[model samples]
Target: MLVDKVAEILAETAAEVIEPRFRALADGDVSEKAPGELVTVADREAELIIAERLRGLLPVPVVGEEAVSADPSLVKAVCSEPAVWLVDPLDGTGNFVAGRPEYAVMAALIKDGETVAAWIWQPTTRLGYTAELGGGAWRNGERLRRAPAGGGPAALRGVVLSRFMPPDLRTAVDARTGGIGTLAPGSRCSGVEYPRVAEGDQDFTLFWRTLPWDHAPGSLLVTEAGGVSARLDGDPYRVGRDVEGLLVAADEESWQQVRRELGLRPVDLA
Candidate 1:
């Protein structure tokens, strides 16, 4: 089974710490970790819970958002380890501090740079997604499978759009269909949208930048749920030090159609 029970613990603990402090105050005591990055008590506390749990459960190593940014080698070593965990205790800290319920607790187990198991939990929504290599994906206790996307223009059916997408890409997408419907879900919540792709709620996801922790867990869920998960270049995605890439996941036909529409290349499928 090879599932890491500690990941479940991390998700549960992170959710517990996050929901209460989401919008504890208007001030929210926000701080800057980098020029453009933001942080809060919730992020640090959640990371602490996840990192401690990983240190106890795994003999390898962990790469977390809050505590390890100062040490690039730590991230590199963990990403290169044959077995490691990529964690984003609070994926959408900015949204959390802004009183949004879209943030989530994300964890993924990687072996040989490939994701073996993943869990993404939204504490406020109480929706949890989990996937094991070949066990299929599940939400709560029920298994999930991709639903049909009607053979109409993608834009007419409320495609979940990405924020700050380049103008040319948006135009090309819109030209292939009608105006995209208002279904753009934010990425602040862990791996929420990946399951949405599996559930047929979100037509596709286009990410210009996604770290190991951001996509690892949810990508497994999407594929296990009878959808496709791969880089924009259509290559098998591998988690590594600061490796950022684009992804698109959907039902087989729609996935292919979207890739063609976007002029994307195919990856070697497993």
Candidate 2:
């Protein structure tokens, strides 16, 4: 299976490139790709290895995070190409650098701009999550099925990724957080956050930035696990779309409740 192959590739690449550098980065190992955005040698090297291995499996363009960072035009392949692979070599670089065990390596196979299969591998825990378009999601060979909807707004627990949100929107979301059962700052890693939502560890997650590499893998996993992953306006999440504000929850009812509680509306990026 392609998902199984990709999982193995991610795991092998992480073991060879990522784990060795965890908390052992030298002074020259890290640098800024943009203001406030960090990239490390491991991220670049792992991306190269993963991209190469994926291309070998299927001859398609690999729109890896580091590759897109180097060549912004490559991002267009995500939506324009018939088939592509989205790769996040090292998610949560800050946590990984700080010796936190919250980082992961993720990849998603997108066909016709929809994620068909995805994988998230956590190096520290050696946990691998895989999901296919119609196939269910799994963690370490165990199928994942989110608990049924049973919570109202006041009983919901969630995380809000507001760091990239507009000030007005952030203020609006913050005002509504008081209505939920529990709200915490996210793990700052979609690889971790998505699995948490799927496994019922968290009831919901609201993300302001909808980067394809970051959300593509996890969105499929959440939905495959019987969760709801959609945009603020209740649109299903599509890879390569330049939209913002995605809300993922344990079920459809919870998703709608969170959207209403947060007072979220369709974003106008223009």
Candidate 3:
């Protein structure tokens, strides 16, 4: 199956390109793609290796993070192409550069603007997660079902990525978070955050930026595991769309609970 092939490719690339450079980056190996946005040699090399292998397997447009960084127009393929591969070669470049083990390699297969299959591989842990549109999600080899919703709004534990949110919205979210059980600043890696939410390690997650490579894979994983993922306005998440404020939780009930607790209402981003 194509999903299986893609999974193998991600693992192989992580082993051959990503893992070796974990803390071995030279002075010239890392550079800023934008102010404060870092990219490393491993990110570029791994994206090339993964993109090539994916194209070889299916001959489709492969929109990788590093590639899109060089040419933003490449991302348009996600909506225009019949089938496209969205790849994040090194998800947590900052963490990896800092010698932290919280990074991952992530990819999602989008067909007709919807995610069909997804994969996330954490090199340090040798853990791989895959999810198909209807085949459900799995980790390593075990099937995954998000833990049942537990506790109330005050007991909810979550990670909120509010860095990109507008000042007023950020302050609003911060003030509201006091009602939740536990809140985190996020791991700075959607690849890691998505799986943690799916497995119930965290009750929910909120993101202001809706980049396809970052959210596509994880969004499918969480939803396929019997969780809920949608825009803050409660719209279903669609790949390649321009919107903001995503809230993902372990289940529908928890989803609504968090939405209400956070005082989130639908906003017209248009």
Candidate 4:
């Protein structure tokens, strides 16, 4: 009941709040949170809108990326809360600033240390994805199902690999897969890869690091869409803890072959 409403509001509010900001990108005020990291006024404004609307739904705490950077302990504390809203407003600020269409407003509902619901709204196209625990995933009100497109090691579409990934791992990935297409959209901050995999835009999404707010929403989205997400060691994802490394593949065959090539164990299988 409440969960259904949460998914609906997230899809609605995100479109409403993010539209104006998208129009103002050229003239938007941009600032750096650190060297090479940026945030726009839209980020703050969008986050404010999201947080306020979420607060109306419940008294649960919100841990936003911009808000938590000043004091990361807030995230640690929120993980202890029975319910918390995790948000990454304007994820892919670089892409947003460069006038690309990959940016999004990301949010997830975490309860008892597990993500139960998530929404990823791509403001430009008005495409929104939502998922609830044990409930199926949806894109624009239609249920999502994964399609196995990439055929074996050679026919994969774009591989969403981060630049922050280790060189050795990258080498291993390249060696096992011949002439694989690589797509580095940068800043996996908002779970961009998760939905991309679900929609068959990308065959695989790899992460050498994990952020709770960033990954939680997309994790459920990907898995709910019939894909599989696992830690580098191949364990089922459990946020509020470090993944050591993470990899999300479109199917079990992809997961098994990729993990074996990297000499990494899937967390839960073995």
Candidate 5:
């Protein structure tokens, strides 16, 4: 499939441009996009490479994290385009920059407000995940099924965005997860977290920002893997929409459990 070929390019890009620079960034290889938001030479190079290659695969518009960050208008363009490819060349920049092998390359295909395809590749772990809209998800080409239910507070594990929330909401959001489940050490990279949940290593993950490049691919991965995802408000994850947040679980049952425990209002997935 075209998506798989894109993944190959990403994996190769990661090997050539991203991995070599890991923990060995030069004086100018790193810079601040804004305080606490980092960008590296590898990210810029990788995206250009991916975008250029994707254009060859199809004429659709290609929007990347770095590109969209520089031009907010691109965000609008993406929202209105018939189809667009969204890329996060290197997620978990913090982890990658800090010498951790936690970042990844992610891409999603959005058409008519829906994400129909996604690819996420974790280079260090050599784990690759892909999903086609109606088809089930796969890891290294093996079919996947999210972990089955049973564990409650003691066995639960997931991602929580409270720490990244505003001061007022942070405390409340953090408290909401208290005692409900353990949070596995996050990669700080949706590329990893999204797959972790879908693969059943984690039970759920909540994000405060539903950026297309970040959540778009992962949302499809979790959902197609037999999990469920939506805005905390019960809206299904839609590409190109700047949503407040997202909640994904191994199953709808777990999704509701987490929402209720957090004191969030619930809506039926159907």
Candidate 6:
């Protein structure tokens, strides 16, 4: 199957390109793409390797995060492509560069702007997650049961989008999340947190950057595992959508709970 083949490539890419460079980055191996947005040698090399090899696994366009950063047009290209593969060669470059162990390789197959299949591989843990639209989610090949709905903001536990939030909104979110369950000490890796959420160890996660390579796979996995993912305005998430950011919950009930806590109605958010 293509997922199996892609998984092999992901494993190989991590073994050869990503793992070796973790905490071993030489001088000049890191540069900022934009302020606070760091890209490392591992990110570039792994993404290049993934782009080269993953493209062979399928005929569709491989819209890798690093590749699209170089050529912004590819983001638009993905929307029109009949099908596309979005790859995040090295998620959590910050943690990896900092010698933290919260990173992974993530990929998703998007057909007509919807995520149909997804995979995430954490090299350090050698743990893997995969999901198929409506086929359910799995961890290391074990089928996952949906996590139950959380209590409320106070019970919500996971990441939030403070980095991408506006100053006032950031303060508000900080206060709101502070009132809730503790924010999971982020590995700064969505690949890490997404699986944590799927396993029901974490509650909800919010993100202001809706990067396809970042959210596509995790979104499907969270939803398939019995969580809910949608924009703040209470709309279902769609790949390549130009929405501001996203909210993921233990279930639809929590999603709306967060939305209400934020004082956003669907008419305003969506």
lDDT of 1 by residue, 65-108 (tens): 77666565666755457888788888877787778777778888
Residues 162-194, candidate 4: write the lDDT tens digits: 365567655756565444445445444455678
Clashing pairs in 3: none
Off by over 4 Å in 1: 1-4, 25-28, 148-152, 155-190, 241-245, 263-270
Model 5 clashing-pair count: 0
> Model 6: which ten-residue window has the lowest total lDDT?
261-270
Ranking by lDDT: 2, 3, 5, 6, 4, 1
Local distance difference test scores for all models: 0.68, 0.91, 0.90, 0.73, 0.84, 0.83
* TM-score, per-candidate, Cα-based: 0.83, 0.97, 0.97, 0.85, 0.94, 0.94
Per residue, candidate 6 scores C-alpha lDDT tens digits across 1-270 of 876788888999999978888878899999998888899988998888888887787878889888888888988866898899899999988888899898999999988888999999999999989999999998888998776765777787777766876677678666765466567656678898788878887777888878888888898998899888888767788987787768888888777777766654544434
For 1-270, candidate 5 gives per-residue lDDT tens digits of 786798898899889899888889999888999888999999999999999988889889998999987987887756788888888999999898899988999998888778889999999899999999999899999998886555665567787866555576667767777767687656688998888889888888877767788998999999998898888887788875565768888888788788877766533211
Between the candidate structures 3 and 4, which one is better when assessed by TM-score?
3
Between candidates 4 and 5, which one is better according to TM-score?
5
Q: What are the per-model numbers of colliding residue pairs?
A: 1, 0, 0, 7, 0, 1
- The stretch of ten residues in a row with the least summed lDDT in candidate 4 is 261-270
Kindly report which residue stretches of model 2 are placed more than 4 angstroms away from their true locations once superposed.
267-270
Misplaced by over 4 Å in model 3 are 268-270
CA shift of 156, model 3, Å = 0.8
lDDT of 2 by residue, 68-122 (tens): 8889999999888999999999999989888899999999999999899999999
